[model samples]
Target chain A: MKHFIVGPVETYKEVQNIYKQPYLYFRSNEFGEFVKETLNRLSSLIGNNDKNSLLYLTMSGTGAMEATIENCVTPKDKVLVINGGTFGQRFCELLKFHNIPFDSINLKWNESLTKEHLEYYENKGYTTLFVNLHETSTGQLYDVKLLSEFTKRNNMFFIVDAISTFLADTYDMSKYNIDVTIISSQKGLCLSPGLSFVSLSKRIIDKIYKTTPSSLYFDFKDYLKNIERGQTPYTPAVFIMYELKAILDLIDNSGGLEKWLSNIKEKCQYFREQICKIGLNIPTTYNLSNTMTPVICDTVNANELVKYLRDHYEICVNPCGGNRANYMFRVSHIGNTTKKDIDILIDKIQKTIEVLAKRN
Target chain B: MKHFIVGPVETYKEVQNIYKQPYLYFRSNEFGEFVKETLNRLSSLIGNNDKNSLLYLTMSGTGAMEATIENCVTPKDKVLVINGGTFGQRFCELLKFHNIPFDSINLKWNESLTKEHLEYYENKGYTTLFVNLHETSTGQLYDVKLLSEFTKRNNMFFIVDAISTFLADTYDMSKYNIDVTIISSQKGLCLSPGLSFVSLSKRIIDKIYKTTPSSLYFDFKDYLKNIERGQTPYTPAVFIMYELKAILDLIDNSGGLEKWLSNIKEKCQYFREQICKIGLNIPTTYNLSNTMTPVICDTVNANELVKYLRDHYEICVNPCGGNRANYMFRVSHIGNTTKKDIDILIDKIQKTIEVLAKRN
Candidate 1:
């Protein structure tokens, strides 16, 4: 089966094989060295400076986002969340759960944030901005350059959830001055789903030390202190950490992040070109992410298309939730997906469209 | 290496082999059924009622403890924590982080909770009580019968962290009137360390639905709804769930928990009797857990004993943290441990004690 459900993406065999070995704990020197090397590799791939502290949490992507809020965001920091989709709204949810005061620039499901939208928050004394760089729920990538410029102009700390966009899109924590960047193992990393990585700048690290977080499990201060010895405050999803190292090595061995990003970009462009030629409508035209394409189905219901693909060809594509469940479905370009695979998917989708026209 | 750390203990070969397969997601009916079956198997193993809700979180044991506090313990409920060791104190820390007021029955490192201790807190208007049934850190298994009687007399909601002693000891949530039971994969389950299980009674589930939780990631409400379809709100550590099913099958095939407990109890008794004959002190002798035995080192330092075993024989044992680091080390009888393995560990410890003189 071709798994393209946006996460728990296809992984390399070597990474999975690492799990065959019995559990490795910090007591073993080999596990300790593996953790330190993986931390270094992941930090390098994200282009973060040495001054920053990077932690791989043992939970999902949402856990990392909440950890960022617990450690970095305080009541004193008035936050502005760019609410575009599910992932964007998650930041607001986390902040609300922690009882932190914040306002959201709520946008329509397919709407992208523009300079005009950010201008309204400027000079409003907001000390922080939260965003999901690639809103995976809708496959819309916001302009980091615009967000960075606005944040720099206002001297606001910027936090980005790059869970789906870290390797699929170009991301440099140093370049964007991103105070905190959150990522997970299942999407671009193409590993298991439990491990989530949080990269914190020196500024964020300082703020973490100065305050008590709302959570004991998701505290970054404890994680940061433990990472010095190449361990987490609690036991982590260690196999995913090994898989993360394997994937990082794969990227580093095949040139670097530059080459990896370009390979994904080429496949993404090829997929988009073939889908358009076959007459499929991608809903959001502006600021599309290379991670996935959100296709709008008019005559053919998106729900049926997804079910048809799964039932007949043993293929899985991500379907939208809520009101757009039957209207839009997503085809991923991340993970170990290839041009040939994308071509086959497009052909299958075309065949699916013809067979399901009368049913829709 | 002969793995013997309290957490991430030695697992069966079949369970480890499950990890070799590629990742499984809820999209597959096989995985969905597997999770549903595992949830049922685990709930049954804990002897939870049919109306109780079970959630397997993709996190460590501490995460589940915090989730119990977040969902079940509201500010309206006055709480009491039985502080015995590191794990018991952890419950206190989690409650404090949420700003919920709770007093603790503080005991010495190896002190056991007794009936006289409970008399002081009796009728104090405490609505809930939290306890680590087996304090894995100090190898003291509290008498749950005594705790249950107290909580019942006081009409308090009883929450227990049965992480290290779930299968090793006799536990019936219904029999004890336990409102919540917390367990993790790495301890008695003998699986990987990422997944944590929380079993909530119908009453606790009703309490969870009444108020907003302090955490979004650890919210029981989202998890409870997703569990209806055999899923988590976020993606979980899938392979562990699969391994959990494999373990449950193994336990059922081997004549259920009663037989499993006898096997562990046999090995635990054999180990203690041998250590006593060999002139070693098994500390906290009054109420020790079948899961592990904490040894008190008088002549030979506990730190030296642990290091010598690891360096000389490639054997790992659970060492105490904080002030007891040099005075005590633990030998575990849980997680695929055999009587022969126990014999080997004891022999190694005896040899290490002879080899390292004046180390203390």
Candidate 2:
């Protein structure tokens, strides 16, 4: 089946083969070298100087986000969360769970953050600003440049959950002044779901050392000690590490992040253009991410459209839950998606619309 | 290379094949059914009642242990940890980190937990008892029957880390009256090292609901809510779950846990007998686990012996760290280990001893 759902997206052949190899011993020097090399590659991809520390967590993207919150956010300092979509709401949920004092700038599903919204939090004394750079729910890409400048001017640490944006967009930790950037394997990495990566600048590391977290699994101090020797404190997803290396190598071999990001941009642009031609509404007029396109339906049910595509064409598209379940469906352009695949999907969706009208 | 090191252990062909399949979308009904089925299979294997809830954590054994501690033990509760080896000490570390008031029964590495030791903690107002059923570091298997009766009489909750011994031994959660049983995939299940599982009784679940844990990744309440619908709060190690189902099916096909346990017992017994014949000392003469055997070296350095085997025969053995670095080496009998493999390992060890003696 052709998979267009957001993540646990289509995987590369070599990466899947790497995952198929028997599990490597986590304590072996060979695995240590692999860990070191992967960290170096990640550092280069994110444009990190040697002053930062990157950690590989054996969990989902949400797990990595929770880890960052637990390690960085304390009740003593105030935080401001940008709530635009499901992933952004997750950061709010995490903050609430930890009882961290925080407020949110809730953007409507199809809306983007503007300078007017930034002005409200300028002198309000939020020590940290948390956001989902590409909110997966609405396909709205939050302006990292504006947020970075605002946070830097106010001397607030910035944390970005780039789970769905890393490889699909040109992201640089140094350029954006992102203190912590969290990503996962299943998104733009095009690997399986399991491992989560967090890259932290020295500033965030210093604050993390000073603060005490409520978690043992995501304790930064323990990770810092183990990562110095190219290991985690506990056993990680061994095969996923190998797959990550394979994907990283693929990106590097194909002219690195610049080429990879442009490829995704082209795919997303082509998909959006076709959807517009098919008379569907794009959910957002703002800068959209090159990850997924959330299309709004007026006459037909989104669930029905997703079902029609899956049953007839053997293709899977994203089905929204909660309030938008019957209104919007998403199509991901990340992973190993191609222009030909998008064209086929558009044709199928066109047929689906006609069938829905007849049913009506 | 032949893997005799504790874990990540060797994998079976069918299990590897299952894991090789491309990633599955987590939000799909297909995955939800898989999750439900895997949990049911795990519950049946451990003899858990319908009232029990089993959670699959995307972490190592230690992470699961911390989850149990965080959700159950609070500052108001007094706890008793049974410290025998590395894993046992880990419980104390977690308890300390949480600031949960606790005392411990520090047993010698090879010593058994007898009735006399239990008498001290009995009726002492301890709310919970934490122990590692099999201490992986020392190859010592603690008696479950004795601890069960003591905890029951004392009206204390019992939490056991059965990581290295779960599939190798006969463990009945209902029979043992264990409130929580922790296990990892890399041990006797012999899959890969990515997922950890915890089985909890209804009583502990009630307490977990009332307590606010210091962690979000290890949050039991969030996990419980999502798991009721056959899901986790975050994306998990997708392929590892497939391998788990494959191994669980293999166990069920091979006459269930009873036969599987006996096979491991036979392998462990055969290995110990061969090493005894070779004039090597068994570190623990007490009740030993079928998972691994710790061989005590009096003449040559254990590290040197491990290195020699790896370099000459391409066999990897577990070398001790800290004080035991020069004294002992471990050989695992779990996974798909065979009698022929054991014979080959013994022959290589004999040659290693001879070579070390020549150097001396």
Candidate 3:
């Protein structure tokens, strides 16, 4: 009943406070101004060096990804997808659904993309490079700057799925040369899920014009047209937009993006130290995500451990899925989560594991 | 500065009360149960006889329409679109964007699709009939029962864009053999515009599996796959969903669907009578939509009248768009609209027209 699942995580009280105001339907000018302010705040957060970068807010992170592909890829256009975890695999699936031609470079679950991988794809003449900055499935963070540079050298469009990274990670669009960076409200923004945002550079916008026309609801061009008036082509989630505005204000007041990212890193480090003391191995040797920690157990059943903690200690954690289910479990330190929350989770997991190990 | 635009007219204080509840994310079982109960109540209101007529909600009415098309129409299949107003034109545009082969019968703004028009499309061998029950732009309501019969007789599918007509208008899916119906939370449902609902019969579900996989975000299969567990495929707008539950409960407590429809009809009659006294002409002789009345002014500028009323009387009404903008304006009686609201609008419009006539 209690959600420990990775996002739509707990929303901040300030985000909750905005929803209390009277609802303005999406068509209202009040909603329009809210959207405009949210975009302006996002641009500021991302450091608005690229005046040409347009932000399109959508229903979810997946909606943003769908918009990116639907707008950027035409039929038969060859795109290179870098797959390491579930989110990366989703990009390939999206490509397949659109019937766009794609070649994927599959990496191990916790592996980061090396420059060699990008160069190989570039040499193969892939027009776009699709990579996840932080793969939620494996708690791996790739160096997007390195990958962006490699793609730039080949004149390829660098599409980064930064859904799990974004505000919590230091990403300079100007430095990375990211053509399209996708993010969502739930992950690093400390808001509830339901909104997704994509910052598109001019180069990417030009490519979208040449791409095959997509469905009306997901049409990036249609969204862009409405963006001028601070409106979406359809009715957007107005309450979520309000929440986004409040969260953006909070971030601005909290020393902006740098302070937010440092706070996440600090919490992640604290959780990692606790995990080490508890004798649990981290699933990934590569860079871990600031949002969550995936730990591997030597002899404990990860699913059982998750359930025992939740049932007995009233603490929640996510049991790993797919091939990682038996040996791995994940604890999210994202959104409004704090050290106290992490301590409660770790303490519960430690006690639960000890009791379960003795019974076994 | 004030929103006098049609439905989403103004969210009720009761609806705002629901939204103000501390923001619980949708992943919680409490929120999930609320959504499930909301759907159940809506099903009863709209006369969904089949237990299998699944109700799936989306971010907006346009999102629901996009999902319907993505699920029902394959690229290889030909669809028949009935374009009578702005929403109908939108459906045609969606078909174009999706690259689905569609033949459209464009009717005049106030004209309703007759049996002859249906036979013409049927003879042309189209497999689907798309109708907008209440054309929001022109204020005309189609007899969906007749159109559904035509589709059934021709062995084709019937999909209705009932966005503005669902609860306010009478519709019996079983009697009419309607395959799919789409409606939104705003318009006739008297809720905010953030949510859109679609009810599908078994026949449409069968066809969706055969359709080429189009979009990931609005995919029906993904929704269906998750709805059994009372979950959406993505993170939904939790606060809005809570509002929907409150709205549906109010609908049930207010004597259910029959009483709701009668109330709409009575409101329309009163509005029409008042408009006639003000010397305005009801342009559409066909059954006027229960939700709104479109009035034509031979001498007064519709836009000017809208501005005068809003600026002077603090009253809001919709100025007709497209070809009708100069000659006509609309007043909606949909969603949480009371007789007092109608009286206020009518009084303001009469006074505004009198002042404008002197200036002319």
Top candidate, metric lDDT = 2
Please provide, for model 3 over A147-247, each residue's C-alpha lDDT reduced to its tens digit, 9 standing for 90 to 100: 87778787788888888877767877767888888887777776655667788888788777676546667777777778877887776665667777788
* Local lDDT at B192 for model 1: 73
Note the residue pairs that clash in candidate 2: none
* Candidate 1 lDDT (Cα, 0 to 1): 0.84
- On the 0 to 100 scale, the lDDT of residue A206 in model 1 is 82
Residue B80 in model 1: shift from native, Å? 2.5
- Fill in the DockQ of model 1: 0.55
Q: How much is the lDDT of residue A110 in candidate 1?
A: 67
Q: Assess the local accuracy of residue A156 in candidate 1 as a C-alpha lDDT between 0 and 100.
A: 90
lDDT of 3 at B324: 77
Considering summed lDDT, which 10 consecutive residues are worst modelled in model 1 chain A?
A19-28
Model 1: how far residue B218 lies from native, Å: 2.5
Q: What is the TM-score of chain B alone in each candidate?
A: 0.96, 0.97, 0.93
Residue range B1-360, candidate 1, lDDT tens digits: 687777788888778776555545465565677688779878988988563288889888988888889888887789999998898888988888788889999989766678888888999899999999998888888988899999999999999999998988888999999999999988888887789999988888888898676668888889888887787777787767878888888888889889999998998899889988778888754588888888888777888788788878888887788878787888888877787888898898888998886443
Model 1 residue B199 lDDT score: 90
Which number leads on TM-score? 2
Candidate numbers, best lDDT first, in rank order: 2, 1, 3
Candidate 2: list runs displaced more than 4 Å: A19-24, B22-24
